[model samples]
Target: MILTVDVGNTRIKAAVFEGNTVLENFVFEKNELEKKIEKILEKFPNCSDLVVASVGNIDKQSFLTFENELKIHFLTNEDVYPFVNKYATPKTLGIDRMVLASGATLQFPKQNRLVIDVGTCITYDFIDENDNYLGGAISPGLRLRYEALHNYTAKLPLLAFEAPELYIGNSTTQAIHSGVVNGFVYEIDGFIDEYRANFSNFIIILTGGDAVFLAKRLKNTIFANSNFLLESLNQTFQYKIDND
Candidate 1:
């Protein structure tokens, strides 16, 4: 068994994979890192490799401590990838985006892929049929939007995400809901529409913490899987091993 970990901006998502199949998934905060990994190891004693892709601020030494239990490999931009990264600033690309693009290129094959990750932030990554990693956009996520409204304004309350009852909200809370939820959905659909107009054999992949929450709300068809990153981490590690 191989353990794949994705250290995102807010949470750490880990998964145990047997070949391409995910046996189980785990999510925990940075403070619970060691305890969670110990529990995971206790449950899956056979897990020999700990593959990690971090885009968070947690210290590298924290993960390195696990070196006594299993082989730990951190995936970085320097790692071998299946696609040609054509970003204007290639080094500035996030590992999470790179992993998502690699997963799309390897899993979908010979198609234009647009990967939208809705987590702490909304990220758009596009890869062409020839496996070229073209750059995409980023925007604040739902929580950030809500926090911004509360922080920047004097009276708007900090609200959690809920589908607005009506398109045109009658009350203050409902209006906030309307603007944030409906507006976000519209922005996503609009981007997809623009991309569809320019590309052929295109596939849009929606993943991240909010993937399932926003999937049905989306007007465009998408392949939604919240675990794409962990799966990709496992696949990318295997690809590196096979090719190395």
Candidate 2:
């Protein structure tokens, strides 16, 4: 069995996979990292291979302790991957992005793929039909836009994400919602259009916290999977296992 861990900025996601099948998945607050790991280990003692794709700065010492206790090979970004690493600064590349790209490669082995991750920050990554990893764009996310409005300006109240009634909002709160949500919808559509024109039959995959919310509003068709990163971690482990 493969134990996959995706440590994000606000939360930690863990999954237990038997081969390609995900048996169970869990999400916990970042503060409860140890407890979550302990629970998983206690519940699923058969988790033999551990793979982690972390975006946040988690404690290395804690991870080391867990690896020693579990007696499993903990795969990190420093490990080898199946796809070509073309990022100019490979060391600085976010593990979440790498895992997403890895997942995309595994899902569409010989197809041009675009992966959009909408979480704390929106990220775009591309992998060609030949399985080469070409980097993509990153922009502020929905909540970031809301927080920017509240933090950068006076009198602008902090807002949470909600679908707006119309494109043109009549009031302040509605206007904020319109700007963030609609703007994102338009931006994503525009990117899809541009990319589709250049690459034929491109597969787009949407994953992250805000994926469901944005997927409903997207004009383009996308394969929406929240467990993409976790699957990627499993794939990464499989690659290592196969090659080793």
Candidate 3:
């Protein structure tokens, strides 16, 4: 078994994969990294490989502590990817995005793919049918929008994400919710629409913390799986091993 980890800006998401199938999934804060992994290992003693793709502030050396128990593989910009990265600045591409792109290429071959990851930041990555990653866009996520309002304004309260009760908010709190949630939904739909205008045989894969919350709200059709990054990390690793 292989344990695939995706270290995002806010949290670490991991999954144990028996080949292409995920046996279990886990989410934990950076501070709980060691404890969480130990518990996972205790449960799945067969897990002998730890594959990680980090886009967080945590030091890479932190994962090395497990070297004795399992082989550690860190996916980096220098590693092999399935797609032809056409980004102008290939070296600057985030490892998380690269993994997502590789997964899209490997899982959905001979098609155009648009991957939208909505977590700490909303990222859009597009790969063409020919397996060329052309890149996408990024915007502030729901939490960021809410925090921005509270931080910039003195009266607006910092609120947790809640579905807006109505499109036209009746109160201050409701208004904030509607503006943030509805506006965010529209922004994503709008991007999907723009992509639809020019692409055919295209597929949109949406993943991240807010994927489920926004999935129902999105007007466009999408394959929404919050655990996609972890799954993709596993696929990417296998691909690297096979092709290396």
Candidate 4:
């Protein structure tokens, strides 16, 4: 069994994968890394290999505490990936994006892939059928958008994410809902359409906290998996084990 961890900006999500099947899932706050990892190890004592991708501010050395318990592979920019990372600045590319693209390449092979991750920040990563990791875009997330509007400009009240009843806002709160929520839906759909316009055999994969809510409204076809990064990490880890 292999333990895969994706340490994002706000939270850490871990999963134990027995080949392609996820045996268990764990979530923890940034500071509770040690305890969450210990719990994963305790519950699944058979796990021998552990892989972690850290894009957050947490120090990678912290995971070294488990070195004696299992073989730990900490993913970084230097790691060899299955695909050619053609990003202009490869060293600065986020490991999460790289692994997510790798997961798309491995899981949905021989296809043009666009991975839209709607997490703390909305990120778009693309890998062509040739397995070249082309860079994508990034923008503020749902909460960030709401918070920004409220914080920067007075009178725009901070509103939580909720689907607007209509495209037109009936009131202040509803307007924020439309602008923040509906606007993102349009932005996502627009991106998908633009990508499809240029590529053939294109696949759009949506994953993140708000993917499910947006997936229901997107006009195009997409493979939505909330735990996409974790799944991708497992595949990336296997590739590393085979090649390294």
Give a tens-digit lDDT track for model 3, residues 131-180: 99999998999999999999999789999999999999999999999999
Error of 2 at 66 (Å): 2.5
Candidate 2: Cα lDDT at 114? 94
lDDT of 2 by residue, 87-184 (tens): 88888788788878887888788899999988888899999998888888999988889999999998999987889997899999999999988998
| Pairs clashing within candidate 2 | none
Q: List the candidate 2 regions with Cα displacement exceeding 4 Å.
A: 72-77
User: What is the lDDT, from 0 to 100, of the residue 91 in candidate 3?
Assistant: 95
lDDT of model number 3: 0.94
For each candidate in turn, give its C-alpha RMSD to the true structure in angstroms.
Answer: 0.7, 1.5, 0.8, 1.2
Runs of candidate 3 with Cα error greater than 4 angstroms are none
* Residue-level lDDT tens digits of model 4 in 73-184: 8888888788998999999899999999899999998999999999989999999999999999999889899999989996788777788987898888888898888888
Per-candidate Cα lDDT values, in order, are 0.94, 0.84, 0.94, 0.90
Q: How high is each candidate's TM-score?
A: 0.98, 0.94, 0.98, 0.96
Pairs of residues clashing in candidate 1: none
Candidate 1 lDDT over 100-197, as tens digits, reads 99999899999999999999899999999999999999999999999999999999999988989999999999999999999889999999999999
